[model samples]
Every structure is written in C-alpha cells, then in structure tokens.
Target chain A: MKRWLLALVLCLSPVFAQHPADSAFSHIYVSIEGGEQYPFGDLIDAVENSFYGGVGFRYAYLENIDGFILFDYSYFKPVPEGVKIYGAHQFSGKLGLDFKWKAIAPLAIGAGFVCDWVRGDYDEDKLDEISFSNDLGGTLTDNETEFGWFARLNLPLIRKETYKVGFNALWKELWTLPKRSETLSVGVYVERRIW
Target chain B: MKSFGKIVKSLVAFCSLASVGAFAAVDAEMEGMEVDQRDDGTFLVGSPTFFYDRILGAGGLHSESEMWSPEKLRQRMLLDRMSILPSWDVMEPSVWIKSGNELGDMIYRDFITAENRPTNRTPILEGGFRTPSFKGFWVTGRAFQDDHFTTSNFSYRKSFVDDEFAIFGENYPMFSTMYAGFGYSANSIDASFLAGEEYIWIFSESSRWIPIHYKPRLEARIDASNIEATVAYEDAEYQDKRKKEKGARKELNGSVYYRCGEACRRGMLQLSAGLAFRAVDDSGMVYTHLEEDRAFLPFVNLRFEPFNNLAMEAMFAVNERDWLVQDSLEFRPPVPRYTGVVVGVKNISGTRLNPLADGEEYFDGDTISLKADGQMNLVQGYTAFSDTMGNVGMGGRVSFWAEHGAETFDVDRYVEDDQMVYRHGDVERINSWIRGVTGELWISAWYREMFSFKALGGFERVDGNSSRFEVTPVEFFTSFTADWLLRKSFRISQSLRYRSDAQWNLRSVDPLVVKGDWYWDATFEQQFPAHGLYLTGTLLHIIGSETIETPNAAENRLRFICTVKKTF
Candidate 1:
C-alpha cells in the first residue's frame, strides 16, 4: 500500500506543477473549545464534557477564489471509575475553495473536501477472564482514512490591520472506502487571521 | 499439492470476481458520474451519509416494599420465594460511530453500565465494530468487560459480485443500478451471573431447588444483488440444557420499478416475495426453543400524488408458516408461523420536509403543518408449548394534527402473557393480549393565544378476554410555549400532565376471584428554546383500591427529580 501510494503521488505531482507561491497565503489560525451533552425526560440523566482543538490556514489562490486547509483533532478523556472507560479520537483535514461575493467586505462563500481518521476503544477485561470467546472478547482497534467534500461560508466580523474575526458555517461529507461509508458534518468555526 | 493448489486458486478467483461484480453494481448506480480524487486528494460523491451518536446517562434509585402478613399468605410455600428490588446509583454511557465510502461501511458501538448498591457493586462494558468489504466480504471484532470476565471476537466476510443495481432521484446523480456483497462476523460474550439470582431463589425456597439458564448465540447475514438471494444463520449453545441451537434461513427477493419511461410521470411501485425456514433441537445441546417451521412472505409498496403537496404511500405484506418438527419436551408440533400486514398514509401541504429540523420555532413549536399517519398490525399464533391452542389479534397506531400546533389519536394492541396466566384455563388454550389507545386535543389559543396552551387527554383499555376483564388508563396533559425568531432560540412556558391506570386481573391461584384497582402519575417540564437544553421533573402516586385484601398493593408516594441538559 505504501509503495502504491508513493507511485500514485509521484505520477500526480506533474499535474500540480503550477502550485501557487507561499506568499499568496493570507492567514493561518487555530482554536480550542469544550462542551457537554445531556438527555431529556424519563430517560437516564447524564452530562458529558468534551474538549477539542484545531488548526487551519487560508490562501488567496485567485482574486475571487481562496484556497484553504485545516486539521482538527478531538478526544474524550477517561472519567469516573467503576464505569467502563471508552474514548474516541478524530482527526480531520479539509481542503477548501472559497468564492468571494461582493455583498459585504471580506465575506466569501467556500466549499471543500475533507479527509479524516477515527479511532475508538472499549475495555473488555471482564469478558476475557470468563473465557467467553465465542463472539465477544478482544481489544478492538481500527484505523480508516475517509475522503469527502465540504462547503462553507466565511463572514469576517471584526476586520483589522493584523487581526480579523472569521466566522464560518461549514458542511462536510467524509467517505471511507470499501464499504463506501459517508458521514455528513455541519459545524461552525471562529478563527483569527494572522499572516 | 495439486488439490491444495486448486482450492487456493478457487478461493482467489471467487473473491476477485465477487469484488468486481459488487463494484460494477455500485458504479452502474452512479449513472455516468466518475468517482475522482480532488487535487487535495479527497473522495467526492456517492450516497447519503451517516454519522456518530454520543450518549450518556446517570440516575438514582429509590424503592420501598412492605412484607406481607402471615394471614394474607395464600399458600405456605409462598414464603419460599421473596422479592427484593435493587436500589442503587446507576450510570450508563454509550457511543456509536459509522463511516464509509463505496466499498462498505463500519459501525462501532459500546454500552457500559455501573451500579452502586449498598450490598454489591456491578459494572459491565461491551463494544464492537463491523465492516463489509467492497465485493461480498464482511469483518467484525468486539470486546466486553465486567467484574468476573472479559471476552472478544473477530470475523470476516466474502461476496459473489462486484456491485448491485440501484436507482436514485434526479436530485442526486446516479450511475449504475446493481450491487452485491458477502460478509461474516464473530462475537463472544463472557460474564458470570455470579451467585446472583440463583442464590436468592435457592435460599428463599424451603425445598431443594436449582436455577439454570444460558444464552450464547453466533449469528451471520449474507445477501446478493437485488435482494433476490440472501442467507442468515445463527448457532447458539446453552450450558444449562447441554444443547446447541442452530438455525439457517435464506430468501430470494426483488423489486421492479414502473413510471420510468416518461418525465411526465412520477411515483414508484415495488413488490417482493420470499421464503424462510428455522429449526431447533430438543436437547440442551443448542440454544434454541426447539421448534421448526417454514414460512413464505410477499409484500408491495406504492407511492403516488394526485396533486401538489398531496402525496400518498401504501404498503402491505403477508406471511404463512407451516410446522416442520414437533417438540419432544412439550409433546407438540411447532406452532404455525404467524401472519402480519401494515398499512400507512400521510397527508399534508408541507410533505417535503427534511428529517432534521432546519431551525427551531419557539411559540409555534417547530414547523407547523396538518397531517395524519397510521399503521395496523395483526398476528395469529400459539400461546405455549405442549398446547394446540392459539390466538389472533390486530393493533395499530394513528396520529392527526393541524398546522397551528394542534393534534390527536392513537391505538396499539400487542401480545402479552399476564392475561393468559391469570385466566387459568388451558394455560396453553388462553390467548394473551393488551390494547392501548391515546388521544390529544390542543387549545393553542387558550394561554396567551400567541402563547399556546394545549390540552391533551386520552383513554386506553386493555382486556384479557380469557380472564374476563379489562383495564382503562386516562390521562390529561397541557403545555404552554412561545418562540423567538425562526426557532433559533426560545423558552417553553411549561407543560403539566396527569395520568392514571385501572388494573383488573383474576387471581393466579384462583381464577374464580377477580381484583381491580387504579394508579396515577404526573409530569412537569421546562425547556430551553434552542432544542439544546431543558429541565424536567415528575410525580407519581396511587389513587384508590378495589379489594380490602389487596388494598392496592402499596402506599401512596411521590418522587422529585430535576435535570438540566446541553447539546453539541
């Protein structure tokens, strides 16, 4: 697989011979946030807090179109003993294209594709000790790279000489092959533009 | 060496051809659009997408039970068995995630529960992930954990074709119309019940007694393009019975589409047929109920629109099963397969709505539209082993509403056994059932008019014809609400509800004697406008008694709870 990917990349390199210079890139930003989820009525009541951080960059490829790349990672930490411990790790990278419409200054509509990786874990110590190997025991691990597209709208709220508040509405579809699974994600991003 | 070489070549050839066929089916469904990687190297296009769900919960336990007086005991041996409820702090956490492209998809989920009781503490953990290959292959792995044991499992899949045929609407691009794949999964379950329920029953009984039960199952599903061919298998073993239970079933199903020749025509029609067979052994060697039967089913689905915003859908199915083997333990032939059918319809102006709410509506309560939906299900089957007796019934659920936050009506009937036990006839001869229906009436203009105050009331009656009695449940509900801009955010005024149920049953030991009574429960809730947060509490109590001997079985009480939530 490694050799195959290397060969494919080598063959495709010539197609991108006219890559834009680094100076064309305008800004790069990163942020971190956390939140909790709770269930409603008659159901068990519980709250779980999750934290995550990400990094992204934008390049002015053309006067009307801007190219951007972003990477985001998130994971849930272990909590309260006596309860089985479960956690997940997600890494997503997005390649975006933004079209600037002159309705407002520094505002643009963007669309892109995202490639992501997800991993999950569930402890099964109790199952192993009982020798119940029929259909239920093992340390589980799977890693898959998902490829898909995304669309976003970027609104610059606080524009300044060196600082700007970039509010973004984004939608993404991640496709994992073989089974050809797809995931749709809608989210918001607040970024600080820095050269 | 020659034989080994032949087997290897056959396996490889089978896999290669299967993958190719599966891909071809998927590609044909793609119409003419080619799948390509972007300059940044990301997969684009295909089918609808799916995502992950993160869930968590926590709750407290509280219960009280009074011991019965000696004079109230119906039998001396009744003292041998006692009931004790476990009260403890319970916490459960679960999560599931699925993602994939054209080849296949993977699903991973985990369930964990922890209980903090005064006497003993128990916690359980389980999770698994499964995915199918591009052709006709599948793979699965799982893990489980608890106080006494740990376990895991792994499995694989193989298919016969490259792709299956499928159709897509104009809104979505389509390429090919056919597809097929094969898959397999291995799972393991390991946990000791401990000296739990068995110990409790053993010590409580005066005479020597032994408790035994076991459940271990291995299941697999396989399918071919067009649903015309499929197979499912389950192999299980029971330690207590020292037997193995295995069942293998296969079906050939397919659907044809009409109205595809002209752009002027719309709506689609589908029809399918299939057969299935199941078998179980009498010895404890396998984990089955030990009955064998064969069944045939046929179904149809139709979609049509006479006018804009007036779309209709209807579907029907029927199943017939014949007994193939008799149960040695029960001394009877397997019960005939039950038959069932479902019909549904929806009528409203705004039928083209997304599954998820695009935005929240505070005062109006989400998007408002008038509509009605309903379904009817019916079945006929035997009540127990060793008996030639049987029962037949019909049940359904229906709902109706108007665009301005008004709604009403529902009825549901399901199979139940309490009625049969109480009737005491041929425990096997009596058929068991429960019927319930709910109705709602909302007066939106009552509270501030702009602030709707809806009233809801419903009555449900359940009868045990075999036992000669019925129970009715009555309930009242009201709610007030207000919305801010297009449902972005708003506050719910409040909702108060009261409910009561009447219970009637013949004595288990003496079918001649009948007892009846009632109980009540209520709920109150306050919610945030964004569909993001809310707090709710409830109260419950018994109202009256019918018999002096039973005195309604318990003391009147109340429960208080407050919960707050946020979503991401």
Candidate 2:
C-alpha cells in the first residue's frame, strides 16, 4: 500500500502544478441529468431502485480539473411488505472535482461529498403511535439527513462547439445508522458551456 | 514515513485557513470545543461550560481554566472556572450555517429492535451572518445551540427546571445563545456592542448541574490606542421546579487594560496593568453569594530581559481578601548552531485560585464553602529543546513539579436522590507536597503547500496520596496528526490519539475511572478561494468508547457536522 501510494504521488506530482487561482469560473457550464439508482448491500432490503433527476453547475477549478455542484431529487419505495409509508422523498446535493487526466481522455473520474435529506410520504389520519414504533418506515415521517462520499466516472459521448452529451456512472455511500448504505447510479447528461 | 511528512505543512495551513489560532476543528465544530480534539494533555469536557483542561508539563494540579489571567477577561465565569465554548466572542466577517447530530440515531434499526432500544440522539444547529464593512461599520447576528450531551441526564436535569430550558429545543442543551450586534473599526479605534439572551448549565463542585438563564446579557467593547476595555451586564434567573425555589442575580462585570506597546516591548523591561471587577445584586434564594456581593481585582504584569539569553516574567494580583502571584524565569543558552534550547523554572503561590468567585454555594440547606482557608504553592523546573533537519523538526521536554496545599474537597457524605447522587463537601487542601514528573517527545515533518505530519507522545508519573486528590491526571498520552491541502483548495485534517485512564477521586465513593481509550477525528474541507466560500464536514470521536466522562453528564458519542460559509 505504501509503495502504491508513493507511486501514485510520484506520477501525479508533475501535473499537480497549481493553476492560476483567479482562473476559477473562467469557463463555466450548466447541465441537466437523469439517473436510475440501485440500492446495494443491506440497503437493498430497506428500499427499492429509484429514478432521479438533477442539475449541475461546473466551472474550471484547475488546468486539468473541473469543479461541479449537483442537486438531485428521487422517490424511493420501501422493500418491506408491511412498511406503512408508500414512498420516501429524497433530496441529495453533491460537490466534487472531476480530474481530466490525459491517460483517461474523454473519461473524467471525480469524487466528492454527498448529503441526502429524506422524508416519508404518508397519510397522517391513519397513523397510530403504537404501530409507528413497530413499523419499518416509521422514522421516515420525520426529516432525516445523512452525509457521505461519492465517486463518479463521466464519459463524454458527443462533443460540440457549445454543447456536449455524456454518460455518468456514480457510486455513493451514506453514513447512516445501524449500518452504512450504498447505491450505484447510472445517468445521461446534456451540458451547455456558459462561457 | 514519507507520507507522514506532508502532515506538518498542512498544520500550518490549518491555522491560517481558520484565520484564528491553532484551535481549529477536529471537533464537529471548532470554536468552543477545542479541547475535544487535543491530545497533548488531559482535556476532560464534563460539559460545554465545565471542563478540566490542563496541558502536560504545565505543572500543578490546578487545571489551566481555574487560574485567572489577564487574557481570559472575556471568558465566561462558571463558578470559579473559566470557559470559552458556547462563546459570544463573535467571528470574522462571514455568513455561515452549520448542523450536526450524534451518529447513533437509528434510521432503520428502530424497526427490528423492541427491547433496550438506543436512546434518541440529539443535534446541534447554528446560523449567522456578519455583513461586510460599510464605511468602517458592520452588523452581525448569530444563534447557536449544542444538544449533544443532554440525553444521558435528561430526566435527572429536567427535575431541576420547569419546561424545556433552552432557546429552541426540548432537549435542554448545555448551552443556547442568540446575539446580534454591530461594530466599527478604523485605523486607531475599534468597538462593538451586543445584547442577547443565553441558557447554560454549569457543573459545580458539589456534583450538580446548575442552570442559569440570562434574559438580556449586554456587552460592549472598545480598543483605542494601547488601551482595551470591555463591560457586560447580565440579568440572570435561576429556578428549581422540584424544590419550588427561585432566584435572580443582576450582575455587572468588565475589565480595562493598558498593554505594552512597541516602545515598551523594545526596552529591557515591559509593564502592563489591568483591573477586573464584578458586582452583583441578588434577590431571593440565589444559591451562591459573593463576599459582599462585589469583587475588585487589580493586577500587574512585568517582563524583564536584562541579558540576551535570560528573561524574567511575573503576574501579580491582590485585593483586600486574598493575593495571588505567578512568576517564571527562563535562560536560553545558545548551544549548537541552528538548535534552540530553553531552561526555565516557574512558581505559583496564591491564597485563592480565583478570588473573584463566589465564596459559598447553597446546596439545599447546606452552606458549602467554595474557598479553602490556607494557600497553595507550586514550583516546577523544566527544559525543552528543538532542532530542524531539512524539512523535519523534533523537540522534547522534561519537567518536575511539586505543589503543597493543593485544593481538594473533603467530602462529608453523599446523598442519592432519584438515581442521581450529590455530594456534600467543603473546599480543603492537601498539606503534604505532591510531586509529578512529566516527559514528552515530538517529531514533525512537512512538505511545501501539500501536506504536514506530526507525532507526539508523553507520560507523567505522579506520586502522592491519590485518594485525597480531586483528580488524578491521565498518566500518558500519544497522538499522530496529519493535514493535507490539495492545491490550496481541499483540506483533510486528521488526528489519531490515545490517552491513559484518568481517575476522579472524590466525585464518588469509588473513583469514576475514565478508562483508557483511543479517539480519532477528521475534518474534510473544500475551499473556493476566488469566491471566498468553504464547505466543511468533520467527524469526531470515531473510535472511542461512548462512556460518561463526568458524573451526571452525558456520554461522548460520535458526531458528524457539516458547515457552509461565505466570507466577504
């Protein structure tokens, strides 16, 4: 592990030369994306796959890197048959830096922190306090938020003078209670350069 | 080894990153909980308002917060102890929002578990903004409350107060403060005035959590030329619902100091003087009483450096009732070419650690004396050395200290009420001399702009009648810290530390031994320099056992906090 880390650092040192700090936001882009997320590990037992849609703001962070901020929304249905709630509404925000290395041309790999806020959509008139404690999705009636990290691979399929079409595959983990939750998402995006 | 070298460079960056001192976030939040992330000594946070913070080699059994000094004039006085957390010190010109929670809240685990379910976890919330200066004037407001440690003693403390004694939540947090004010700054003058209400729980020597509610605490500060002055007024209310008792205290406290300027600092002798005073008017059962309801402490500081390598420093404070003196002498012998070495000895002799604190505490009907009759004297000798090799630096220090008449409690007995125990005691002292020897070693390595690393370890051997002491300090501690800043934008500051068991001797019948444990804390931050923006997330107490560190206090659970801020 030490040798591998040393090699990676040595390999990246020459390119690690920082760009002009003032050059940030010099080149900006806006994008819209739609994705389908699949629950993994223990999360599979808790929730089913869901589709999400989000928007992103990207800017030049370095000579070979782009910084991006994303905000997305999704609806998840509980897997448990006896769960009281029909579905949960989740809003996620992500911030990351996409590395555009020459060795991985046209494929930018990025990683950053992600936060999710969830609330269960249910009918209050039919709810009972005793049953809520014994039900699977009772806690979702209140606002629940968790933060974690994410990694994504961005593949630009078609490049144009002012617009680009791309595919994104991302993996995220939420630092949830009882255990951690993981998901894999695949999405397509359309980006338009702003500057 | 090479990876660790990048750690120290980032430590330096972490200090600059916060624009404050080295007290940055390893805790979920940084300002008031600096001791949470420290591994250099025994920093036990019994509560936000009460803690036993003493760095190794500091000498004496007295915790650092108990010793009053000129610099701590702005710190809140909780009984005799001083603290800066849940501080109203204000922040730099920035707008920020922060929120966090204890990590054990069951998101889905609540469904399958029927018996012995985990207690509900609490959270913290803070949001404020300080606008940019307009014509040398600015406005600021902040509301922050931490509810992490309120769950363990929730029912026990709820019996003491009516309703939910906090600003926003029913959790009855240790502190909740909301303040708004404005300030003006110029070349020669700077001043500010602020008014707000605050709720705080202070742990007393009698093993009870005393809650104080300040309706409108007003403070004003002005620094002009070489003189700095500050004053505050607090209308505080206290109540005990179970006992059906109520009290109020209207108090005024402030300080004014004329500091030594460049001209005085350039000379062989430097002198500064200050006066700190507090006066109160009490009505009803106030639970505590100041001697004559007033205290005036006039203090002076002197620094004499007659020779190139020798220096002497001392601080003296006295009133009609008591006197305190702290002095130190140091000699820096020019040894090896690029190495620095310091040999010093210091002494502290005082009738009362804090003469301004209330002299008596009223527990039920018992009048517990807060001040001992005799004085305490402590003396210590130490030597420290540091040397740099290329990008690495190493230093070590050894010290031996002894104290006589160390402050302790002679517990008369203990009374249990509703699963809560309270002690009856009067402040006393150990007449016999208690001795301690401490040794510490550290090595630091750094890389330019990218990373910094430091590893330090220390141990102290204290030989004394342990049962009589108030707190037997942690015998040993070790810490490895690292900080990495990628391209001056992304930061990862991490620390892994271990501290030996520290025993509290008199808080209970058989000491409450805080067992040995290791703790890990990390903070990851992303900065947008051109936009003056930062996004930060910190995780604290990742690997330590969630045990109650103090009597009647809550467990120290793992916490995660995220903050977003934009500066002008």
Q: DockQ: which candidate is best?
A: 2
- Model 1 lDDT at residue B407: 15
- Residues A30-55 of candidate 2 have per-residue lDDT tens digits of 99999899988767777789999999
CA shift of A69, model 1, Å: 25
lDDT of 1 by residue, B387-481 (tens): 11122122222322112111111112122232122111110112233232233332222212112222223333323333233211222222221
What TM-score, computed on C-alpha atoms, does each candidate reach? 0.28, 0.89
- In model 1, the runs with Cα more than 4 Å from the true position are A1-195, B1-230, B241-270, B285-438, B442-457, B461-499, B502-568
Model 1 Cα displacement at A48 (Å)?
27
The candidate that achieves the highest lDDT relative to the unseen native structure: 2
The alpha-carbon root-mean-square deviation between model 1 and the true structure, to one decimal in Å, is 26.5
After superposing the true interface residues, what Cα RMSD does each candidate give? 22.8, 7.9
- Supply DockQ values for each candidate: 0.05, 0.28
- What TM-score did chain B of candidate 2 earn? 0.95
Tens-place lDDT digits, model 1, residues A40-151: 2211111133444576666554445566667777564333333232555667766555778777657788765455555545555543422321121111133433354566
